[model samples]
Target: MLEQFGAAIQQVNLSTPVLRLFGTTLALLLFVLVSRALLSKLIRTGIQAPELRRKWLVQTRNGLILLFLLGLVLIWGQELRTLALSIVAIAVAFVVATKELILCFIGSLVKGGARSFNIGDRIQVKDFRGDVIDQNLLATTIMEVGPGKLTHQRTGRATVIPNSLFVSEPVINESFTQDYVLHVFTVPFKRDDNWQLAQQVLLDCARAQCEPYLESARKYMRRLGDRRGLEVPVVDPRVSLQVPLAGEIHLVVRFPCRQGQRSAIEQAILLDAFGSHDFSGKRKEGDEEGEEPSAVIE
Candidate 1:
C-alpha cells in the first residue's frame, strides 16, 4: 500500500502544470547560463583579427542576449504583450527628443566611412575656409583664413563647423587631390620701372624657387584629367601683365607651390625681385628712396 501510494504521488507530481512549467523554466535558465559562459570563452580566446573580433563579439553577444530575452518572452509572452504599447510609445518619445544629436552622430559615421576629407586638409564650407585642425562626432575645428590682414593667414581664432552641414553644403577640399596648389600673386610696378624686365626677372625667380612643386603638380593634374576628365592647365610658370589701376602695371605670376610654403615663396620671390630693381607700386610720404612693395590682393 505504501509503494502504491508513492507511485501515485510521483505520477501526480509529473502531471501538475505549474510544477512542469517551473521545471522547464529552471532548465532553460541553466541552458542560458552555460551557453553564455561558452560564448564568452570563445570570444575571448578564439578570435584572431582585432577588428573582426570586436565586431563579432558585439554582434554575437547582442544576438545571444536577444535570444535569451526572447526565450523569457516565450515563457511569459502574455505578460509582455500587455506592455508592448507602452514600450513603443517610450521609444518614439526618446527618438524625437534626441533627433539632432542622432543626426550629428550619423553625419560623423558618414564622414569617417566616406573619407570626405582629413585633418590638415584645407577645406571651405559656408564661407569658412581653413586648415582642419580637429574633427569629432558633432563638429570640425579649423584655423580660419580670409582676406586683408587675414589673406591666406590665420586669424588666431578657431572656427567650429557642424558635420551635419556636409550633407547639404558643398565641401571644397583643396588638399584632397594633391599637396601642391596653383598660387597666383600679382606684383605691381610703376610704368617707369622697366615692366618688361621685371616680368622676366619674376618669371626666372618663380621657376627656380618652385621647381619641385611644378613637376609634381603637372603629374597630378594629368592624373586628374585622365581620371576625372578635368581640364589640365599649363603647368609651366606664366607671367601675364594686367593694368587694373592707374600708373601701375601688374605682373600676375602663377605657379605651383606647397600650401604651407606660400608665404615663404612669396617672401623669397619678393626679396629676389627687390635686389634686381625697385619693384614698388606705392611710396609713402616724403620717401627719398624707392620702397619695396608687397603683393596686392583684389
Candidate 2:
C-alpha cells in the first residue's frame, strides 16, 4: 500500500500540467535572478555616484521581479482559473464562517479611508461614548467617557468595540473642535416654577463662564467653517426653552468652553445659577409665609 501511494503521488507530481508549471516557474525565477545580478553589476560599473547606482540596481531588480511574476501569471492563468472555480464553494463557506472578521477588516478600511476619527478623539457610537485609546483591525479600545452623556466624565473603565460597528453606526466626534467646543446642557424646571427666572439665571451663568474663550472659539469656528465649507453655529452662549411634556420645561444652554473643561464649566454655571436664586422654592427665615422662593431647578 505504501509503495502504491508513493507511486500515485509521484505520478501526480510528474503530470504534464504540474511539470509545465514547475519548469516555467523555475526558469522565470532563475532568469530574474541572473538578470538582477548582471544589472546590479552593470549599474555599479556604469554609475559613479553611489546613490544613482543603488537607485538603478533597485529599479532593475523591481522591474525584473515584476516581469517574472507577470510571466508566471500568464503561464499558469488557465490552471489558476480552473483551481479557483473548483474552490468556489469552499471559498463561499470560508467567507460565511468568518463574516464578522471580514466585516471588521472592511470597517477598518472604511474608518481609515473616511478619516472618521483618530486616537485621543472623543467619539460616540450608539450607546458607547469614550476617548479612543487604541485601535486595531479587529476592534477599538476606548476609555469610557460617561455613565450618561450629561456627566461628561470618564468612568475609569475601558471598552473594546468591534470595528464592524463603524459600518452601521454613525460616529459622533465631540473633539472635532480640538480645544474649544460648544457644550450644551439642560436645566429642567417645573411649569409652575419661575422658568423665566431660571432661564435668565442660566443664560447669565453660561455667558459669564464662557466669556474668556468666547472670542477665540468664535474665530476658530469661523475658520473651521471656511476651511470645511460648513455652516457652523455661533459659539456665543445662548439659551433655548423646550417643553418635553405638559408642566415640564427644560432650559437648554449652549456655551463655549475648553474641551477638557466641559464638566467643570457646567458645574460652575450650575452652582452660580443655584446660588443666585433659590431653586428649591423654599422661603428664607426673613420671608413671610406663602412667599415662593423661585423657580425650582430640577
Candidate 3:
C-alpha cells in the first residue's frame, strides 16, 4: 500500500507540466519587477562616485535584465535553439517596423547620456528654438522663445518637437559654459566732456563691473567640466573696441548670461550709460530704425 501511494503521488505531480511552467513564469515576472526597483536604487547610490559614468551603468543594467529574461524564456518555454532564433527574428522585425523611432530614440539617448544639455538648456534644434523642458523616446518638449532674436521671456507656450529632426541645422546651446554675461556701456563725450577722459572712465567702469564675472565664469566652467568629465570650457566673456559704422569709438563688451538675459542686459547698459552721459539718438525717431548706424546688437 505504501509503495502504491508513493507511485501515485509521483504520477500526479507530473500530470500538470503546463501549470508548473505558468507558475515559474509568474515567479520570474515578480523577480524582474523587484530587480528593476532594486537596480534603480543601486544606480542612484552609484552616481555619487565621480569616476563612474551613470549612463554606462544604466545601459549595462538594462542589458543584463534583458539577457536574463531571454535566457529564462529559452530554457523554460521551449527548445533553446528555436527560442533564440525566434527572438532574433522578432528583434529584426521590430527594428524594421520602427526605424525612424529607433533612430530618434538613439539620438536622444546619446544627447542625454553625454550631458550635452539639461532641462533648462537653451537649445536650438533645427528651427525650433526654445528651452528644453522634457525628453523621451519620441519627442522633446520645448518652450518656444522667438524667431530671429531667440529670446526666452515668453507667454508660456510650449512646443513638442520630434527628436529626429530632418533639417541639417545647427543647435546652439547658450550658456553651455557659464552664466553672468556682460554688456558694454558706451558714453561718448560731445567733443567737450574730455573724450579721452570719458573713454578712460567708461572703460575702467566696464572692466571693474565685468572682470569679477569673467573670473567667476572661468572658475565655474572649470568646475562644471570636472564634474561632468568634460575637458574644456566653452564660454568666456570678452571686451574690445572697434569702429565699423563711424561715430564715437564703439566699445564691444560681451558678458556671460543666463538664458533670456540679453535684452535685459542691453537695456541695463543703455540706462547706465545714459545716467552718466548724454545720448541723443540725434537721428530721427525712424531715420536710423533699420539702418543700423554705429549700433551693433551682437
Best by lDDT: 2
Compared with the true structure, model 1 gives a TM-score of 0.54
Q: What is the lDDT of candidate 3?
A: 0.58
Report the backbone clash tally of model 2: 0
Give Cα-based local distance difference scores for all models. Answer: 0.74, 0.82, 0.58
Model 3 misplacement above 4 A: 1-97, 112-114, 166-170, 178-215, 221-252, 257-264, 274-298
> Model 3: clashing residue pairs?
180-256, 181-255, 181-256, 181-257, 182-255
Runs in model 2 deviating more than 4 A are 1-87, 282-298
Tens-digit per-residue lDDT, 1-298, candidate 2 = 9999999998987797788888988988898888888888888889997545654665576568669879989989988898997899999999999999999988988887998987677999999999887776779888898888877899999999999999998899998877678888988888767666677778778888887878889898988888899998777888887889997889888888887899999999999998768755533455434343334322
Clashes of each: 0, 0, 5
Give the clashing residue pairs of candidate 1, or none.
Answer: none
TM match of model 2 to true structure: 0.66
Per-candidate TM vs. native? 0.54, 0.66, 0.51
> Model 1 Cα displacement at 66 (Å)?
20
List candidate 1 segments past 4 Å from native: 1-115, 145-157, 188-195, 227-229, 243-249, 280-298
